[model samples]
Target: MSNIVKKFKVENGKGFKLGDFDPAYSDGFKKIEARKTLKDLIDETFDLQTELYAANKYALLIIFQAMDAAGKDSAIEHTLSGLNPQGCQVYSFKQPSTEDYEHDFLWRHYRSLPERGRIGIHNRSHYENVLVTKVHPDLLLKEHLPGINDVKDIDGKFWDKRYESIRAFEKHLTDNGTVIIKFYLNVSKQEQKLRFLKRIDNPKKNWKFSAADIEERKKWADYMDAYEKAIKETATNDCPWYVIPADKKWFTRIAISSVILDTLKGLKLKYPVLEKEEKDKLDESKKQLEKE
Candidate 1:
């Protein structure tokens, strides 16, 4: 675990520090080997998750946030590939609809929360209440938070209050047996530009490119400030955030898999056992079937 954490540097309010991994020492073959190892670990983790689901002990909520081309989709597709589809659900939040805007910020999000004994993944989640709303103050007018209408320096206070609300909301969920793991895919600006260029150069990927994305890139600094503040304010022990380095795809996959495996490990799940009478009945049934 320590070796995995040392591979990437994670940054937050406490300041930047090396993660439990050092990927630089790993060559291409070594990285591939690590990914293969991660695949096996994830398979075992899914078995545990299935057992945990049957036990109805808890629900797992994973949130993924990242800039365009940060491998958010790929990370999820690969890392969660081993889990049973029935036990997992994925929701991708796009632009808000009129119905979505009609309610409070978390209304759409709460609607998608996982049931007991299931895993829910949010592609881009309710944190957008702070991130996108900060970038475009006009969006707040759509939220309709009471008392926010007349507040002075409303931009700063609005987000501050929202952060507090989010923290409390997540705490309530945690208290109710939901384990939340938030991930922020940190990619450098240079890498983002290269990815954007790739979209232009490739015909199939071009469908994902948008003019609005370019417009958003101009506010990169503003978005970063919003992300930095939101992460610092909302991260808590019960619902901690894992900042993942998105430079190398294999490293990102391994880091995500490790974090998820570690989180699930603490659940201590086991398959349910049959009572003595039930076991005897099963043996008799097997004997009858064998005679047939």
Candidate 2:
């Protein structure tokens, strides 16, 4: 499991390329084998989460970024199922609301951050400012920035600044006890097309199929380039990106669960121990309760 985490983790941005990863790779684990591994990982994560909540020293921020139909939702659902709801918060960032566009790109995301001792899951995150907007430069126009008056104005220097902003933002969060884990579900174009077809073919899934999805699909190459650039620019040792394979949903879930469990274990969280005074008080209270 540690090897799998290391294999997919991007700790440094230097010379990173998304295409180097195989979307269908499963690390020799069949579905049956992965199921058992996933269960054990989830159970351990649950126990660690309890200690984490009691310690109240660190907040886990898990971010997922992917193309359409890359199984981000399902992977999150299956992997984080064992978490205590009271200690977990999930935010799915969609098309920016009117209010969202009015502030700096990270404003809404900052508002949604989890407090210490909790886990926050972002379905799609502030990376969208770099990934989606980089792919469709026109979206920056909606941000209503002074210099970004036209798509043409969003040049190489503009993108470099956004990437720099992201790196600084993540650094500040990590310094403030936010443990960030980023995942990029690397789904191949062929698999994405098949998933899109299934949504269209199944009556129950028809609602999941959007015409806009196809429009995004048409720019798959552009998205890939943007993702590569974003990962290369912002990945750091403290905040690495895990490019998880998404062609096989089962494998994706297992890999993600392993990474999360590894992260929690690294934190070395422990349930708070009572001091001598508190222990004595508890003993005295127990004696009174017994008399009653």
Q: What local lDDT score does residue 5 receive in model 1, on the 0 to 100 scale?
A: 44
lDDT of 1 by residue, 95-210 (tens): 88999988878889999999989999999999987888778877676666666564344766667778989999998999999889888888777788888999999999999899
Q: Model 2: runs farther than 4 Å from truth?
A: none
Model 1 residue runs over 4 Å out of place are 3-29, 148-153, 275-284, 287-291
Q: Compute each candidate's TM-score over C-alphas.
A: 0.88, 0.98
How many Å off is the CA of 93 in candidate 2? 0.6
**lDDT comparing candidate 1 with the true structure:** 0.80
Q: Taking the tens digit of each residue's C-alpha lDDT, what string does model 2 give over 235-289? A: 9999999999999999999999999999999999988889999999999999999
The lDDT, on a scale of 0 to 1, for candidate 2 is 0.94
> Alpha-carbon error at 25 in model 1, in Å?
10
